[model samples]
Target: MDFQESKTKENLARSFAAECQEGARYQFMAKMAQQQGYQYMSMLIRTLAHNEMAHAQQFFNKIVELGGNQTQNIEITAGYPFKSGELLDVLKQEAENEHMSAESIYPKFADIARDEGFEDVANLFDMVSKVERTHERTLKKLHENLSCNCLYKCNDEHAFKCDECGTIIMNKCAPKTCPLCKMGQGYYRIDFSIN
Candidate 1:
């Protein structure tokens, strides 16, 4: 489908820029998480960054296939409430971004793509929207737990994956260090879904 002269092309271009920026943002967040000793969180965030890059690549390919070119420069401007120095504030802002993307932006883009007969793009948008929702939920929980000082003492035994050695462990609290890799508690990914 040659969507070069269509609104969908413009939308795709914009989405591509957003995805690229998101990838960079996630990478920055991942670095901050690692600096804060949240190794598992850092790993997860880096994975997300990679996913975002994949999304951007897909969008770029689709745009090119539709005969769109980057001969003309695009000026992108964006602003969010997150500051790099504050972890809690950044988490809240990221959650808010995910909520907006899942609830509004991605849904609208998916609808447009569907209407334009771009089923593949629509499906990708829908999948990304779902993932954004999950990210939003997780970030909210993390923010809440950190605020309440209950991240390590929630009395909830849930499965955790060691980010260092990929060992799965079921524990109510994060271990001081992974037995397999000798990594700290921050290297474990704990599930917060259980009450």
Candidate 2:
């Protein structure tokens, strides 16, 4: 495949994976909410899962509609990368991934639509892009206030130590700031777990 073809395939794969992951996460949330006696949240999660499934199907249809093969296989990893135990975290990750995918994929689709003389389709993609941008902003707000225990426990004390202040903060704090120097976290080099 050429560069454009490769990029298209990657974007398609990432979008497909994001949709599947969001669907599964919503389903999981629904089940967990039910068990936790949160009936309203459970129903909402179920509804969201339905929406994600529709989105996934729509994306598949669009690929075929645009003269792309429908049988292309995509591999979905096992678990979500973000903190999935918290509802807000789940929503934030979903929205962020959707926005990222929209930013990367929708433009390509729009370009294709324009090349094919489908001005209406291009306009639709533009609208989708705007929606995704809104979603990204909303999720960022949610992520800022939400907190949860680290999904993966790290045993290496050196990993949590801030390079500037040399303070050994916990995993959660390791991503935020150095308690001593107040330097921005994620600045120190530390191996992140791949969920």
Instruction: Return the top candidate by lDDT.
Output: 1
Whole-structure CA lDDT of model 1: 0.76
lDDT of 2 by residue, 104-176 (tens): 7678767766665656556756666665666566445434433342322244443455555566544533555
Worst 10 residues of 1 by lDDT: 73-82
Error of 1 at 151 (Å): 2.8
Model 2 error, position 65 (Å): 2.9
lDDT of 1 by residue, 9-108 (tens): 7777777887788788888888988898987777777887887788788878876665646435434454434356577877788888889988998899
* Every candidate's lDDT: 0.76, 0.56
**Residue 48 lDDT in candidate 2:** 63
* Root-mean-square deviation of Cα positions for candidate 2 versus the true structure, in angstroms: 14.5
